[model samples]
Target: MRYDTFLDEVLVKVKTYLAEDGTLASSRDSKSLAKTSDLKLPLEGSDLSSILVDIDDYLQKCVKTNHPNFMNPLWGGLNIAALAGEIIATLTNTSMYTFELAPLASLIERSILERMCEMVGFSNGGGTLTTGGSNGNMLGMLCARSRGEPLSQRRGIDGTKLAVYVSAESHYSVEMSANVLGIGLDNVIKVGCDDDGRMRPDKLVEEIERSIAEGQRPICVIATSGTTVRGAFDPLVELSEICHKNEIWLHVDAAWGGSCLFSIEHAKLMAGVELADSVCWDAHKLMGVPLICSAFLIKDLSLLRKVCSHGDAAHYLFHDETESDDLGRLSLQCGRRNDALKLFFAWRERGDSGWAKMVDGYMELAGHLESLVVEDPQLELMSSRQWTNVCFRFKAEEEEDASELNTEIRERLMQKGNYMISRSNIGEDVILRPVIANPGVTKESLEGLVAEVIAHGEDARRGIPSA
Candidate 1:
């Protein structure tokens, strides 16, 4: 078949899957089907009919993340403009290693990075786009380490006991990075958090002082702007003051809710982010861009280049002395995809106000979900609707067993492929975590979810004993 015909067939299937009710399947399942002996590429010059089975099998197992009911992970929904950009990017197959190879992509990434830096209040700031939040965090910590011990790049991290501090509730990637950078997990300190789940600034200050007292070098403090589990924001201003006084590098991981920067009302929650030396952000989360889109931005452009790259080997990437602003040199990876294309397209389509409107819609939906839980005595709102994550528990009705009932209810929902919501234990109470990151979700949809959950809970507890 012609390439155009093949493309048309695939697009048709994709549209059908998107309009359908359930997901096709996971990628792993698709790969398994594709790897079958009959599906292998031995029959190279085949007619359309020859590979039809393999094509169908591969497409059949693809997950339908664009479905409105897919609320399991933080990344949900699809942006049409971004999707079109992805198609263009794939067609071009541009390598972002140098400006010559990807002039448009290089300019786009730098532009977006600059815009993101300005959003964080970094007037003279610059940054690089990463594959995801984890890599972004890695970049921030690497920069912090370089700044803390300039000689570590050559002599390596001497047993000077250099350490990084984060809240107990911070993303696990912070600690994982500590291990990867040879800092050792023991050197990473976990600060305490308050009942609201926000990192306690007082405790952080005390911990840093104590670390210094014990002959440990407190080098960097990672303040999470939006945490993963509870969707909590740390006290940035308070933490900034402490980090500034001691000259410790401050980095903010706003991977999940960093898009709130576009929202004027909620933007204040991330105040003092300008004080951070570096920040890790994920555009894919709230921006509705494609997956694996994140960035690690730093206030000082020289810092990122100095620490991350050696300018001595700049002949290949930077020939023009006047224009040495290519992105590949600052990044860890060499042959990077033009991930910025989709993000740039989305930003262009939905300017500041449009993006803010999308975020506000999610916030409003979350608030509605909160109200729904409040109205029902059987369901208790676990925490306030901070960001778009709504944490609530299916409370026991008089003599009913709550945990077992909620667990069974969650299982039933997932089994039926109706609505995908998650469950977590907060202080021994089983709570449902529904994230309204998708703009397609409405108040009525959330209310219906609550009803389905409660209905399943009631059914599950028919003969179960009370705790």
Candidate 2:
């Protein structure tokens, strides 16, 4: 096939995929899919026409994350402007390590980071585009470690004596960060959260005091702005005060709720965020940018540089004249992608006001869904709705096992493949969690989701096996 013909065919497929009002994903199990798909890696290369067939097959089986019912993950929906930027970046492939290689991309990334820092109340602060929120969290922890023991960068210290604190409901990345930083998982003290899932200030103080009494140095307190299951935001103001008093670094994981900063009314959810030492915000989540567009902003840019510092070794890449302009000097990555262009394009297209509107709209939709859940006799709201995550479950009858029934309902939903939501737990009770970060989700779509959930619940209660 000709190159233009291949490109045209791909574009048509893209358009068709966007216009599709179909199921979120294929119902095929892993074994079934693996058995059916072409798995052989032939020594001989195939023609462009064969490649197009493979592409079509792949697209057909892939989950349509851009679908209206795709409320499974923290991020969904496609931003066209950002998509364009992604393609452009791919077309002009370049590493983001040096200004000499990626001058324009470096500037764009810096501008995005600066704007994010300003939003977080970090005056004269800066950060770098990371792989994802996990990487950002790790970076934040690294900075905290560096600050707590400045000389540890050269002479490693006993991580067993260094302690880090986070909410019991915080992301698993914190534990991973501790493990990576040589701070044993046991050193990561899980702070207690209130009924609403926010970390309790008093409990935090107790934990810190206890750690100190035990001869352990509390190095950092990582707070979550939006938790995974409940979408809870920890009280940043109180936590920052505690950190300041204890002379510990505070890092806010606002990966899921950072976009709340765009709205005047919602920004208060993360109040006192400016007082934190560092923050990791994911533009890919609420901002609707493509994957891997997360930023790890720090109040002290020099500290971040120090944390990521490497002795002069790559003479081929670094020059004294352009060292200040090089982004790699401040990043853990070397051959990084230009993830900033997509975010920059999206931000330019939808200015601050536009993002504010999006945030407010999502909240309103979530409120509507909550109302629907409340009005229904068979459904129950598992937790208080803070962000867009609606945690609910089908109320079981006297003899029915609630968790088992809900699990079956979710399985049926997956098999049906019309709506995609997550099945989670709150304490011991199983709950259905459908987040509203996807731009494709509307009030009507949410209404349909509720109806589908109720329908599936009814079926499960009747002991009807999923087709």
Candidate 3:
């Protein structure tokens, strides 16, 4: 078809989709419309119009996380500024590899990285925007690994076994980084956590000593600022001390909880974050930036350059570094997208005060959830209110079979499509996890979530599981 026709079609489709946003939260409609079968793919070439039809159908059927009642993952709600940045980014199609290719993106990225490092209290620091938290963690590990064994990059790990450490409750991406870095998973030590799920500094120290005694070289200690399972934060101050004294590279995987830096009360949870040699944060998670905007910031700017520098590669794109902007030297990727544009736009649009208010507002909502759990006689709070994730469970009427019944109730809720809450096994009992990372969720929405849980539990007791 003609370009004008395609443009008109795209605009019409976009407007149509926008109109359906309010009704996107209708679970009744979504459940009936959703397909469980495999999607068909075109074997031969198809027109853009045909593809658009299929795409729109799938999108409309999918859960709209941007909706007010759509609270599934960490991030939700839309930031107009970041959305605008995404459109510009797609149009530019610029790669951050060299100055000539992405001069303005490089500058924006540098400013964003600097501001992020400062938020983490890194005075002399620099970083690069990453694809997401996984990539950010990978970059952090890469930098740490390179710092320990400079020759490892050139010769590769032949026989040397370098160990990285994190709590048992830490994100799976830590081990993934070890695998990608060619360091075996066996070398990644999973230290024990305390009763509240926070990593025990003493256990960490013991693990490091054990690894060293077992003929393993301990190089990096990854402290989780926000663990995936429980949103538990390892004691950064104590862990940093242990890491620094032992000459281990300290890196904070604060991808989920990093936004707490914007909140005065919550930022205290990530105390001693500045002591780390490197930190990984996802702007998409708590900062409410668009997807694919995460950062891997190093305490020292030169360390990142040294780890990922491909010097002496004289190319047209990288030639005019002094005259143009370049961010490739300190990145894991060669052809990086303008992920910083949206994050930069988000920060600029909100300013510092607006961002802080947003963060503090979420914290208040989490606090409200904590109170709800505490007030309810049936629900028991598993973890203390740390950041925003609240882990709890529906208690049995008396103590006949609370644990098992609660676990069954959570399963039934998901199967029935009443509501969705994450489940976690803590100290032999499974608890419902309501992660309040979405800014769109309000008190009323959370109350509705509780009501749904109770209603589902009542159904489970009656032996009528939700369909």
The lDDT for every candidate, in the order shown, is 0.82, 0.92, 0.80
Please report the TM-score between candidate 2 and the true structure.
0.98
lDDT of 3 by residue, 1-467 (tens): 67678878877776666556444433444445555423667588777777667767666556566655555577776787898899899989988887677878888888898888899989989888888888878888887888888887788884247888888888888888888898878888899999878989999889888888888888888888887767888898999889889999998999998988887767888999999988999989887787878888888887777777664364644555452256777776787788888888888889988888998988888889889889987678987767778888887776458777887887766565545567777778778887776666889988988887777778777788476
Off by over 4 Å in 3: 1-52, 158-160, 311-317, 320-324, 397-404, 415-418
Q: Scored by Cα lDDT, where does model 2 land?
A: 0.92
lDDT of 1 by residue, 338-368 (tens): 8999999999999999999998888888888
TM for every model, in the order presented, reads 0.92, 0.98, 0.90
Per residue, candidate 2 scores C-alpha lDDT tens digits across 299-330 of 98999888877834778877888878999988
Stretch of 10 with least lDDT, candidate 3: 21-30
Highest TM-score model number: 2
Ranking by TM-score: 2, 1, 3
Pairs with backbone N, CA or C atoms under 3 Å apart (clashes), candidate 2: none
The model with the greatest lDDT is: 2
Ranking by lDDT: 2, 1, 3
Model 1 scores a C-alpha lDDT of: 0.82
* Candidate 3 or 1, higher TM-score: 1
